[model samples]
Target: MDAKETLSGLPWWVKWIAIPVIALVVFGGLITAVIGFIVGLLFKVLVFAALVGGVIFLVRRFTSASSSSRGDW
Candidate 1:
């Protein structure tokens, strides 16, 4: 039979059982999303730290290089 015929044949208890199962599935999806968000935040923090550190290193190198060149002249 087609899906509509199969659903219509199911007893009332079938619908009741479906409710809690659907709720559990939805709750699982929400938990997965929260975990993914936390992991993404950690990755962003690491990337930001690396970028800031690189900029500071570059600025220090440029300042030291310029100061040494001026003394030589």
Candidate 2:
């Protein structure tokens, strides 16, 4: 049988609701996954930045103190 004949066997509501509902579910899943990946990447970037800043701070403190001690001699 043709597509129309096959679909016509089902109730009209099934045809209308089933197609749209399935489409929404598939599209929604894809949207959710993309959003999740973006948020996770942002989190990783922020953490890496914080670690780099902390290392710079410690190095600056140690070097300044060593320099001042030598200058006093």
Candidate 3:
């Protein structure tokens, strides 16, 4: 039988609720792990951007300060 015919033969609750619940029960751990990995990757990318920006700020500050001091040397 085709998918549409199979689904039509099932009860409404079975189609709407039971299938989803069963799917979650079967793959919940896998779904949670995949979501966790994506979140972690996003967090690490944000941290990397923040660190690079901080380094650039520090370099610019020091360079300007040293250039000003160069005239006194």
Candidate 4:
């Protein structure tokens, strides 16, 4: 009645290859969806970070340039 006793009688391919293939066939969609969501979230975070950095750089560049032009430096 134990799993080890049941699996021991099966062929090696059944234990290794068949079982894993069957599991993926059952749960593959959920696994793919979860992975896709994580990748998309990471991409959005990277894009937001780039936009914020660009804004900071432009602000600093223009502010410094205008102040120097005004002979404040």
lDDT of 2 by residue, 1-73 (tens): 9999999899988899988888879798888889999999999999999999999999999989998989963
For candidate 4, what is the TM-score?
0.80
- Cα lDDT tens digits, model 1, 1-73, are 8977977878877767985788879798888899999999999999999999999999999989998989964
Residue-wise C-alpha lDDT for candidate 3, range 1-73, written one tens digit per residue = 8999999988999999999999999999999999999999999999999999999999999988998989764
Per-residue lDDT for 67 in model 1?
A: 87
Query: Among these predicted structures, which one has the highest TM-score?
Result: 3
User: Which residues of candidate 4, in runs, are more than 4 Å off?
Assistant: 1-6
lDDT of 1: 0.89
Q: lDDT of all the models against the reference?
A: 0.89, 0.91, 0.97, 0.98
Compared with the true structure, model 2 gives a TM-score of 0.60
Question: After aligning candidate 1 to the native by TM-score, how far in Å is the CA of 45 from where it should be?
Answer: 0.5
Q: Candidate 4: deviation at residue 54, Å?
A: 0.8
Model 1 sits at a Cα RMSD from the real structure of: 6.2
How many Å off is the CA of 19 in candidate 2? 9.9
True-vs-predicted CA distance for residue 39, candidate 2, Å: 0.5
**Candidate 2: C-alpha lDDT:** 0.91
Candidate 3 — which pairs collide? none
Off by over 4 Å in 3: none
Candidate 2, which segments miss by more than 4 Å at Cα?
1-23
